[model samples]
Target: MNKAIVVTGTPATGKTTVAKAIANKLNLKYIDVNSLIRTHNLSEGYDDKMKCDIVDTDKLNRILKQMIKDSDQKLVIDSHLSHHLPKSYVELCIVTKCELKELKQRLEKRGYSKAKVRENLDAEIFDICRNEAKEKGHNVIVINTSEGSKDIDDVLEEFGFLKQFEA
Candidate 1:
Protein backbone atom coordinates (compact mmCIF):
# COMPACT_ATOMS: atom_id res chain seq x y z
CA MET A 1 0.00 0.00 0.00
CA ASN A 2 2.94 2.32 -0.40
CA LYS A 3 1.68 3.50 -3.72
CA ALA A 4 -1.11 5.97 -4.31
CA ILE A 5 -4.61 4.71 -5.09
CA VAL A 6 -7.50 6.81 -6.25
CA VAL A 7 -11.18 6.03 -5.77
CA THR A 8 -13.28 8.11 -8.11
CA GLY A 9 -16.86 8.10 -9.37
CA THR A 10 -20.01 10.16 -9.50
CA PRO A 11 -21.14 11.55 -6.16
CA ALA A 12 -23.09 9.17 -3.93
CA THR A 13 -21.72 6.22 -5.85
CA GLY A 14 -19.83 4.89 -2.79
CA LYS A 15 -16.40 6.32 -3.66
CA THR A 16 -15.95 7.63 -0.14
CA THR A 17 -17.01 4.43 1.53
CA VAL A 18 -14.84 2.25 -0.66
CA ALA A 19 -11.85 4.58 -0.47
CA LYS A 20 -12.03 4.88 3.30
CA ALA A 21 -12.42 1.15 3.75
CA ILE A 22 -9.42 0.48 1.53
CA ALA A 23 -7.37 3.11 3.33
CA ASN A 24 -8.27 1.67 6.74
CA LYS A 25 -7.58 -1.88 5.66
CA LEU A 26 -4.23 -1.07 4.06
CA ASN A 27 -3.19 1.60 6.56
CA LEU A 28 -3.05 4.22 3.85
CA LYS A 29 -3.78 7.88 4.38
CA TYR A 30 -7.21 8.92 3.14
CA ILE A 31 -7.08 12.21 1.27
CA ASP A 32 -10.44 13.81 0.68
CA VAL A 33 -10.16 15.79 -2.55
CA ASN A 34 -12.90 18.23 -1.59
CA SER A 35 -11.04 19.20 1.57
CA LEU A 36 -7.83 19.45 -0.38
CA ILE A 37 -9.45 21.81 -2.85
CA ARG A 38 -10.69 24.10 -0.10
CA THR A 39 -7.48 23.96 1.87
CA HIS A 40 -5.32 24.74 -1.15
CA ASN A 41 -7.56 27.38 -2.67
CA LEU A 42 -7.78 25.40 -5.85
CA SER A 43 -11.28 26.46 -6.75
CA GLU A 44 -11.64 28.91 -9.62
CA GLY A 45 -15.19 29.81 -8.60
CA TYR A 46 -18.47 28.28 -7.61
CA ASP A 47 -20.67 26.69 -10.19
CA ASP A 48 -24.10 28.05 -9.36
CA LYS A 49 -26.00 25.78 -11.65
CA MET A 50 -24.12 22.70 -10.50
CA LYS A 51 -24.10 23.64 -6.84
CA CYS A 52 -20.40 22.84 -6.58
CA ASP A 53 -16.92 24.23 -6.88
CA ILE A 54 -15.36 24.96 -10.22
CA VAL A 55 -11.89 23.64 -9.58
CA ASP A 56 -8.75 24.18 -11.58
CA THR A 57 -7.97 20.60 -12.51
CA ASP A 58 -4.40 21.30 -13.60
CA LYS A 59 -3.58 22.93 -10.29
CA LEU A 60 -5.26 20.14 -8.43
CA ASN A 61 -3.24 17.57 -10.30
CA ARG A 62 0.00 19.41 -9.66
CA ILE A 63 -0.65 19.73 -5.97
CA LEU A 64 -1.69 16.12 -5.67
CA LYS A 65 1.40 14.99 -7.53
CA GLN A 66 3.55 16.99 -5.16
CA MET A 67 1.75 15.56 -2.16
CA ILE A 68 2.26 12.02 -3.39
CA LYS A 69 5.91 12.71 -4.00
CA ASP A 70 6.42 14.19 -0.54
CA SER A 71 4.52 11.67 1.56
CA ASP A 72 6.02 8.53 2.96
CA GLN A 73 2.61 7.07 3.70
CA LYS A 74 0.47 5.62 0.94
CA LEU A 75 -2.64 7.57 0.00
CA VAL A 76 -6.15 6.77 -1.12
CA ILE A 77 -7.44 9.88 -2.87
CA ASP A 78 -11.23 10.09 -2.96
CA SER A 79 -13.28 12.26 -5.29
CA HIS A 80 -15.15 12.25 -8.56
CA LEU A 81 -12.41 14.55 -9.81
CA SER A 82 -9.55 12.32 -8.71
CA HIS A 83 -9.51 10.35 -11.95
CA HIS A 84 -8.17 13.43 -13.65
CA LEU A 85 -4.76 12.81 -12.14
CA PRO A 86 -2.15 11.44 -14.53
CA LYS A 87 -1.77 7.67 -14.44
CA SER A 88 1.92 7.79 -13.60
CA TYR A 89 1.14 9.03 -10.11
CA VAL A 90 -1.27 6.28 -9.22
CA GLU A 91 -0.92 2.57 -8.62
CA LEU A 92 -4.61 1.90 -8.96
CA CYS A 93 -7.69 3.81 -9.93
CA ILE A 94 -11.03 2.47 -8.73
CA VAL A 95 -14.32 3.63 -10.21
CA THR A 96 -17.46 2.93 -8.24
CA LYS A 97 -20.91 2.58 -9.77
CA CYS A 98 -24.44 2.28 -8.46
CA GLU A 99 -27.81 1.54 -9.99
CA LEU A 100 -29.44 4.71 -11.27
CA LYS A 101 -32.49 4.25 -9.06
CA GLU A 102 -30.34 3.75 -5.99
CA LEU A 103 -28.16 6.68 -6.95
CA LYS A 104 -31.17 8.96 -7.35
CA GLN A 105 -32.43 7.96 -3.92
CA ARG A 106 -29.03 8.63 -2.39
CA LEU A 107 -28.79 12.04 -4.01
CA GLU A 108 -32.26 13.04 -2.84
CA LYS A 109 -31.45 11.87 0.66
CA ARG A 110 -28.46 14.22 0.62
CA GLY A 111 -30.91 17.07 0.04
CA TYR A 112 -29.46 17.96 -3.31
CA SER A 113 -31.66 20.17 -5.50
CA LYS A 114 -33.44 18.52 -8.36
CA ALA A 115 -31.17 20.07 -10.97
CA LYS A 116 -28.05 18.93 -9.14
CA VAL A 117 -29.48 15.47 -8.73
CA ARG A 118 -30.28 15.26 -12.40
CA GLU A 119 -26.79 16.39 -13.39
CA ASN A 120 -25.09 13.81 -11.23
CA LEU A 121 -27.50 11.10 -12.29
CA ASP A 122 -26.66 11.89 -15.87
CA ALA A 123 -22.97 11.62 -15.09
CA GLU A 124 -23.51 8.20 -13.58
CA ILE A 125 -25.72 7.08 -16.44
CA PHE A 126 -23.00 8.02 -18.91
CA ASP A 127 -20.27 6.20 -16.95
CA ILE A 128 -18.37 9.43 -17.17
CA CYS A 129 -15.81 8.77 -14.46
CA ARG A 130 -14.94 5.28 -15.58
CA ASN A 131 -14.59 6.34 -19.19
CA GLU A 132 -12.41 9.30 -18.33
CA ALA A 133 -10.15 7.23 -16.10
CA LYS A 134 -9.59 4.76 -18.91
CA GLU A 135 -9.14 7.51 -21.49
CA LYS A 136 -6.34 8.83 -19.31
CA GLY A 137 -4.62 5.42 -19.44
CA HIS A 138 -5.13 4.60 -15.79
CA ASN A 139 -4.84 1.12 -14.40
CA VAL A 140 -8.52 1.03 -13.65
CA ILE A 141 -10.98 -1.24 -11.88
CA VAL A 142 -14.73 -0.81 -11.90
CA ILE A 143 -16.68 -1.82 -8.82
CA ASN A 144 -20.44 -2.12 -8.85
CA THR A 145 -21.52 -0.88 -5.48
CA SER A 146 -25.22 -1.19 -6.02
CA GLU A 147 -27.19 -2.54 -3.08
CA GLY A 148 -27.15 -6.34 -2.67
CA SER A 149 -24.04 -6.76 -4.81
CA LYS A 150 -20.98 -7.29 -2.60
CA ASP A 151 -19.80 -5.91 0.70
CA ILE A 152 -16.50 -4.07 1.06
CA ASP A 153 -14.57 -6.97 2.54
CA ASP A 154 -15.78 -9.36 -0.09
CA VAL A 155 -14.87 -6.92 -2.80
CA LEU A 156 -11.43 -6.52 -1.29
CA GLU A 157 -10.94 -10.26 -1.17
CA GLU A 158 -12.08 -10.60 -4.75
CA PHE A 159 -9.44 -8.06 -5.68
CA GLY A 160 -6.76 -10.06 -3.84
CA PHE A 161 -6.30 -7.73 -0.91
CA LEU A 162 -6.62 -10.56 1.61
CA LYS A 163 -4.60 -13.14 -0.22
CA GLN A 164 -2.41 -13.89 2.77
CA PHE A 165 -5.42 -14.76 4.88
CA GLU A 166 -6.73 -17.37 2.48
CA ALA A 167 -6.26 -21.04 3.40
Candidate 2:
Protein backbone atom coordinates (compact mmCIF):
# COMPACT_ATOMS: atom_id res chain seq x y z
CA MET A 1 0.00 0.00 0.00
CA ASN A 2 1.16 3.50 -0.72
CA LYS A 3 1.91 5.38 2.49
CA ALA A 4 0.72 8.85 3.37
CA ILE A 5 2.49 11.08 5.86
CA VAL A 6 0.55 13.97 7.29
CA VAL A 7 2.59 16.95 8.45
CA THR A 8 0.53 19.35 10.56
CA GLY A 9 1.15 22.16 12.99
CA THR A 10 0.30 25.71 13.97
CA PRO A 11 0.99 28.45 11.44
CA ALA A 12 4.69 29.25 10.79
CA THR A 13 5.87 26.03 12.39
CA GLY A 14 7.67 24.97 9.19
CA LYS A 15 5.23 22.22 8.29
CA THR A 16 5.43 23.11 4.62
CA THR A 17 9.19 23.19 4.59
CA VAL A 18 9.46 19.88 6.39
CA ALA A 19 6.90 18.26 4.14
CA LYS A 20 8.76 19.37 1.02
CA ALA A 21 12.08 18.15 2.35
CA ILE A 22 10.70 14.76 3.27
CA ALA A 23 9.03 14.41 -0.10
CA ASN A 24 12.22 15.27 -1.96
CA LYS A 25 14.33 12.92 0.09
CA LEU A 26 11.89 10.04 -0.19
CA ASN A 27 10.84 10.67 -3.79
CA LEU A 28 7.24 10.97 -2.68
CA LYS A 29 4.63 13.30 -4.06
CA TYR A 30 4.25 16.40 -1.92
CA ILE A 31 0.76 17.74 -1.48
CA ASP A 32 0.16 20.91 0.45
CA VAL A 33 -3.56 20.91 1.24
CA ASN A 34 -3.51 24.63 2.02
CA SER A 35 -2.18 25.33 -1.45
CA LEU A 36 -4.86 23.10 -2.91
CA ILE A 37 -7.53 25.00 -1.04
CA ARG A 38 -6.16 28.29 -2.29
CA THR A 39 -5.57 27.18 -5.88
CA HIS A 40 -9.04 25.72 -6.26
CA ASN A 41 -10.78 28.55 -4.36
CA LEU A 42 -12.55 25.90 -2.32
CA SER A 43 -13.11 28.01 0.76
CA GLU A 44 -15.61 30.79 1.01
CA GLY A 45 -14.56 34.40 1.70
CA TYR A 46 -10.81 33.72 1.59
CA ASP A 47 -9.97 37.27 0.66
CA ASP A 48 -7.39 39.66 2.08
CA LYS A 49 -9.78 40.98 4.69
CA MET A 50 -10.82 37.59 5.98
CA LYS A 51 -8.64 35.21 7.89
CA CYS A 52 -8.89 31.74 6.40
CA ASP A 53 -11.23 29.59 8.35
CA ILE A 54 -11.02 25.80 8.41
CA VAL A 55 -12.44 24.28 5.27
CA ASP A 56 -15.41 21.99 5.49
CA THR A 57 -14.16 18.67 6.84
CA ASP A 58 -16.18 16.54 4.45
CA LYS A 59 -15.05 18.50 1.43
CA LEU A 60 -11.47 18.48 2.54
CA ASN A 61 -11.55 14.75 3.17
CA ARG A 62 -13.08 14.10 -0.21
CA ILE A 63 -10.42 16.09 -1.96
CA LEU A 64 -7.66 14.36 -0.05
CA LYS A 65 -9.07 10.93 -0.75
CA GLN A 66 -9.19 11.71 -4.42
CA MET A 67 -5.66 12.94 -4.41
CA ILE A 68 -4.40 9.86 -2.67
CA LYS A 69 -6.26 7.61 -5.02
CA ASP A 70 -4.77 9.40 -8.01
CA SER A 71 -1.20 9.28 -6.84
CA ASP A 72 1.05 6.35 -7.83
CA GLN A 73 3.58 6.83 -5.03
CA LYS A 74 3.65 7.62 -1.34
CA LEU A 75 2.57 11.13 -0.38
CA VAL A 76 3.73 13.83 1.99
CA ILE A 77 0.58 15.73 2.91
CA ASP A 78 0.94 19.03 4.74
CA SER A 79 -1.95 20.86 6.31
CA HIS A 80 -3.24 22.35 9.55
CA LEU A 81 -6.31 20.11 9.49
CA SER A 82 -4.74 16.78 8.65
CA HIS A 83 -6.34 15.18 11.66
CA HIS A 84 -9.76 15.75 10.24
CA LEU A 85 -9.05 13.51 7.29
CA PRO A 86 -9.57 9.76 7.25
CA LYS A 87 -7.12 8.13 9.59
CA SER A 88 -7.00 4.91 7.62
CA TYR A 89 -5.25 6.68 4.78
CA VAL A 90 -2.43 8.09 6.86
CA GLU A 91 0.65 6.06 7.70
CA LEU A 92 2.26 8.64 9.94
CA CYS A 93 1.19 11.97 11.40
CA ILE A 94 3.70 14.58 12.53
CA VAL A 95 2.96 17.77 14.44
CA THR A 96 5.63 20.42 14.19
CA LYS A 97 6.08 22.69 17.20
CA CYS A 98 8.20 25.69 18.18
CA GLU A 99 8.90 27.93 21.15
CA LEU A 100 6.05 30.40 21.67
CA LYS A 101 8.26 33.48 21.44
CA GLU A 102 10.00 32.18 18.34
CA LEU A 103 6.68 31.27 16.75
CA LYS A 104 5.32 34.72 17.48
CA GLN A 105 8.36 36.34 15.94
CA ARG A 106 8.15 34.17 12.83
CA LEU A 107 4.47 34.86 12.36
CA GLU A 108 4.99 38.55 12.92
CA LYS A 109 7.73 38.54 10.31
CA ARG A 110 5.23 36.86 8.00
CA GLY A 111 2.88 39.82 8.55
CA TYR A 112 0.46 38.12 10.91
CA SER A 113 -1.28 40.32 13.46
CA LYS A 114 -0.72 40.02 17.19
CA ALA A 115 -4.09 38.37 17.68
CA LYS A 116 -3.40 35.72 15.07
CA VAL A 117 0.04 35.03 16.48
CA ARG A 118 -1.34 34.70 20.01
CA GLU A 119 -4.06 32.33 18.87
CA ASN A 120 -1.53 30.09 17.14
CA LEU A 121 0.78 30.16 20.15
CA ASP A 122 -2.04 29.10 22.40
CA ALA A 123 -2.94 26.28 20.04
CA GLU A 124 0.62 25.01 20.02
CA ILE A 125 1.01 25.19 23.80
CA PHE A 126 -2.24 23.33 24.28
CA ASP A 127 -1.19 20.60 21.84
CA ILE A 128 -4.21 21.02 19.65
CA CYS A 129 -2.71 19.16 16.73
CA ARG A 130 -1.43 16.37 18.94
CA ASN A 131 -4.83 16.01 20.55
CA GLU A 132 -6.46 15.82 17.18
CA ALA A 133 -4.02 13.14 16.09
CA LYS A 134 -4.74 11.15 19.23
CA GLU A 135 -8.45 11.43 18.69
CA LYS A 136 -8.01 10.22 15.12
CA GLY A 137 -5.89 7.24 16.24
CA HIS A 138 -2.88 8.38 14.24
CA ASN A 139 0.68 7.47 15.13
CA VAL A 140 1.82 10.95 16.12
CA ILE A 141 5.36 12.31 16.06
CA VAL A 142 5.96 15.71 17.55
CA ILE A 143 8.98 17.71 16.40
CA ASN A 144 10.14 21.12 17.59
CA THR A 145 11.30 23.43 14.80
CA SER A 146 12.51 26.44 16.74
CA GLU A 147 16.22 25.82 16.27
CA GLY A 148 16.48 25.67 12.48
CA SER A 149 15.55 23.83 9.28
CA LYS A 150 17.79 20.87 10.11
CA ASP A 151 15.29 19.79 12.72
CA ILE A 152 12.93 18.76 9.93
CA ASP A 153 15.52 16.47 8.42
CA ASP A 154 16.12 15.00 11.84
CA VAL A 155 12.44 14.28 12.14
CA LEU A 156 12.32 12.52 8.79
CA GLU A 157 15.32 10.48 9.83
CA GLU A 158 13.64 9.57 13.08
CA PHE A 159 10.62 8.40 11.14
CA GLY A 160 12.92 6.19 9.02
CA PHE A 161 12.15 8.09 5.84
CA LEU A 162 15.82 8.93 5.33
CA LYS A 163 16.60 5.25 4.80
CA GLN A 164 16.27 4.05 1.23
CA PHE A 165 14.13 0.98 1.94
CA GLU A 166 12.15 2.20 4.93
CA ALA A 167 10.04 4.70 3.05
Candidate 3:
Protein backbone atom coordinates (compact mmCIF):
# COMPACT_ATOMS: atom_id res chain seq x y z
CA MET A 1 0.00 0.00 0.00
CA ASN A 2 2.94 2.33 -0.45
CA LYS A 3 1.23 3.84 -3.43
CA ALA A 4 -1.52 6.38 -3.03
CA ILE A 5 -5.11 5.27 -2.48
CA VAL A 6 -8.14 7.51 -2.82
CA VAL A 7 -11.36 7.15 -0.86
CA THR A 8 -14.07 9.06 -2.62
CA GLY A 9 -17.79 9.22 -3.26
CA THR A 10 -20.84 11.38 -2.51
CA PRO A 11 -20.50 13.95 0.26
CA ALA A 12 -22.11 11.91 3.01
CA THR A 13 -20.99 8.48 1.89
CA GLY A 14 -18.42 8.01 4.69
CA LYS A 15 -15.21 8.52 2.71
CA THR A 16 -13.38 9.83 5.74
CA THR A 17 -14.35 6.96 8.00
CA VAL A 18 -13.31 4.28 5.53
CA ALA A 19 -10.16 6.10 4.46
CA LYS A 20 -9.04 6.69 8.02
CA ALA A 21 -9.69 3.10 8.92
CA ILE A 22 -7.56 1.92 6.01
CA ALA A 23 -4.83 4.37 6.85
CA ASN A 24 -4.80 3.27 10.47
CA LYS A 25 -4.79 -0.39 9.55
CA LEU A 26 -1.98 -0.08 7.06
CA ASN A 27 -0.04 2.62 8.93
CA LEU A 28 -0.43 4.92 5.97
CA LYS A 29 -0.63 8.69 6.19
CA TYR A 30 -4.20 9.93 5.92
CA ILE A 31 -4.33 12.95 3.68
CA ASP A 32 -7.42 15.07 4.11
CA VAL A 33 -7.95 16.67 0.69
CA ASN A 34 -10.08 19.47 2.16
CA SER A 35 -7.36 20.48 4.55
CA LEU A 36 -4.80 20.19 1.78
CA ILE A 37 -6.87 22.53 -0.36
CA ARG A 38 -7.06 25.13 2.39
CA THR A 39 -3.42 24.75 3.36
CA HIS A 40 -2.11 25.00 -0.17
CA ASN A 41 -4.53 27.68 -1.37
CA LEU A 42 -5.81 25.43 -4.11
CA SER A 43 -9.26 26.94 -3.90
CA GLU A 44 -10.70 28.27 -7.11
CA GLY A 45 -13.37 30.11 -5.10
CA TYR A 46 -16.14 29.57 -2.60
CA ASP A 47 -19.38 28.17 -3.92
CA ASP A 48 -21.88 30.20 -1.99
CA LYS A 49 -24.83 28.23 -3.26
CA MET A 50 -23.35 24.84 -2.46
CA LYS A 51 -21.51 26.09 0.63
CA CYS A 52 -18.38 24.35 -0.58
CA ASP A 53 -14.94 25.25 -1.83
CA ILE A 54 -14.32 25.22 -5.56
CA VAL A 55 -10.97 23.49 -5.76
CA ASP A 56 -8.42 24.08 -8.45
CA THR A 57 -8.20 20.45 -9.56
CA ASP A 58 -5.16 20.90 -11.75
CA LYS A 59 -3.23 22.53 -8.97
CA LEU A 60 -4.48 19.99 -6.48
CA ASN A 61 -3.26 17.17 -8.67
CA ARG A 62 0.16 18.74 -9.10
CA ILE A 63 0.60 19.24 -5.40
CA LEU A 64 -0.61 15.78 -4.60
CA LYS A 65 1.75 14.26 -7.15
CA GLN A 66 4.62 16.08 -5.52
CA MET A 67 3.54 14.92 -2.10
CA ILE A 68 3.45 11.35 -3.28
CA LYS A 69 6.91 11.60 -4.73
CA ASP A 70 8.27 13.33 -1.64
CA SER A 71 7.38 10.56 0.76
CA ASP A 72 7.70 6.82 0.89
CA GLN A 73 4.82 6.49 3.32
CA LYS A 74 1.60 5.15 1.85
CA LEU A 75 -1.20 7.71 1.60
CA VAL A 76 -4.96 7.43 1.84
CA ILE A 77 -6.42 10.54 0.27
CA ASP A 78 -9.99 11.38 1.23
CA SER A 79 -12.41 13.58 -0.73
CA HIS A 80 -15.07 13.36 -3.37
CA LEU A 81 -12.68 15.32 -5.57
CA SER A 82 -9.85 12.86 -5.11
CA HIS A 83 -10.92 10.67 -8.01
CA HIS A 84 -9.99 13.49 -10.34
CA LEU A 85 -6.35 12.80 -9.62
CA PRO A 86 -4.34 11.24 -12.43
CA LYS A 87 -4.36 7.45 -12.35
CA SER A 88 -0.59 7.24 -12.56
CA TYR A 89 -0.39 8.73 -9.09
CA VAL A 90 -2.94 6.44 -7.56
CA GLU A 91 -2.72 2.69 -7.00
CA LEU A 92 -6.29 2.12 -5.90
CA CYS A 93 -9.39 4.25 -5.80
CA ILE A 94 -12.24 3.20 -3.52
CA VAL A 95 -15.68 4.67 -3.96
CA THR A 96 -18.04 4.53 -1.02
CA LYS A 97 -21.73 4.24 -1.72
CA CYS A 98 -24.89 4.06 0.36
CA GLU A 99 -28.53 3.35 -0.41
CA LEU A 100 -30.23 6.48 -1.71
CA LYS A 101 -32.66 6.55 1.20
CA GLU A 102 -29.93 6.16 3.77
CA LEU A 103 -27.75 8.55 1.83
CA LYS A 104 -30.47 11.19 1.83
CA GLN A 105 -30.96 10.84 5.55
CA ARG A 106 -27.24 11.15 6.13
CA LEU A 107 -26.97 14.24 3.98
CA GLU A 108 -29.97 15.84 5.67
CA LYS A 109 -28.50 15.07 9.07
CA ARG A 110 -25.41 17.02 8.05
CA GLY A 111 -27.64 20.13 8.02
CA TYR A 112 -27.03 20.79 4.32
CA SER A 113 -29.61 23.01 2.65
CA LYS A 114 -32.24 21.29 0.56
CA ALA A 115 -30.44 22.07 -2.69
CA LYS A 116 -27.15 20.76 -1.36
CA VAL A 117 -28.77 17.61 -0.08
CA ARG A 118 -30.47 17.04 -3.41
CA GLU A 119 -27.22 17.64 -5.24
CA ASN A 120 -25.29 15.09 -3.20
CA LEU A 121 -28.11 12.60 -3.33
CA ASP A 122 -28.23 12.83 -7.08
CA ALA A 123 -24.50 12.34 -7.29
CA GLU A 124 -24.82 9.14 -5.26
CA ILE A 125 -27.78 7.80 -7.23
CA PHE A 126 -26.03 8.48 -10.49
CA ASP A 127 -22.74 6.95 -9.33
CA ILE A 128 -20.87 10.08 -10.31
CA CYS A 129 -17.69 9.35 -8.38
CA ARG A 130 -17.46 5.75 -9.53
CA ASN A 131 -17.95 6.72 -13.15
CA GLU A 132 -15.38 9.48 -13.00
CA ALA A 133 -12.79 7.22 -11.41
CA LYS A 134 -13.24 4.70 -14.18
CA GLU A 135 -13.03 7.40 -16.81
CA LYS A 136 -9.79 8.52 -15.27
CA GLY A 137 -8.42 4.98 -15.78
CA HIS A 138 -8.09 4.31 -12.08
CA ASN A 139 -8.22 0.82 -10.65
CA VAL A 140 -11.47 1.36 -8.84
CA ILE A 141 -13.47 -0.55 -6.24
CA VAL A 142 -16.97 0.20 -4.97
CA ILE A 143 -18.24 -0.52 -1.49
CA ASN A 144 -21.72 -0.28 -0.04
CA THR A 145 -21.46 1.77 3.10
CA SER A 146 -25.09 2.09 4.03
CA GLU A 147 -25.73 2.82 7.71
CA GLY A 148 -24.48 0.19 10.23
CA SER A 149 -22.45 -1.44 7.48
CA LYS A 150 -18.72 -1.48 8.01
CA ASP A 151 -18.09 -3.71 5.05
CA ILE A 152 -15.37 -1.32 3.87
CA ASP A 153 -12.81 -3.45 5.71
CA ASP A 154 -13.95 -6.55 3.91
CA VAL A 155 -13.67 -4.76 0.60
CA LEU A 156 -10.15 -3.68 1.45
CA GLU A 157 -9.22 -7.18 2.43
CA GLU A 158 -10.67 -8.54 -0.78
CA PHE A 159 -8.55 -6.02 -2.66
CA GLY A 160 -5.49 -7.53 -0.97
CA PHE A 161 -4.68 -4.42 1.05
CA LEU A 162 -5.07 -6.07 4.45
CA LYS A 163 -2.90 -9.00 3.52
CA GLN A 164 -0.35 -6.74 1.87
CA PHE A 165 0.01 -4.80 5.11
CA GLU A 166 0.09 -7.74 7.48
CA ALA A 167 3.44 -7.77 9.25
Index of the highest-TM-score prediction: 1
Please list the C-alpha lDDT of all candidates, in the order they appear: 0.87, 0.79, 0.85
* Better model by TM-score: candidate 2 vs candidate 3: 3
List candidate 3 segments past 4 Å from native: 147-161, 165-167
Which lDDT tens digits does candidate 3 get at residues 1-167?
25688899999888998998888778888999999988898888899889999887888888888888887787889989888988888988989989999888888888899999999888887899999999999999887778454666766666675546432
Ranking by TM-score: 1, 3, 2
Rank by lDDT, highest first: 1, 3, 2
- Taking the tens digit of each residue's C-alpha lDDT, what string does model 1 give over 1-167? 24579999999999999998888777778999999998999989999888899998999999999998998887889999888988888888999999999899999999999999999999998999999999999989888888575578778867885333122
Q: What ranges in model 2 sit over 4 Å off? A: 47-50, 148-151, 161-167
Q: How big is the RMSD of model 2?
A: 2.4
Tell me which residue pairs clash in candidate 3. Answer: none
Off by over 4 Å in 1: 161-167
Q: After superposition, how far is residue 140 of candidate 3 from its true place, in Å?
A: 0.7
TM-score between candidate 1 and the true structure = 0.92
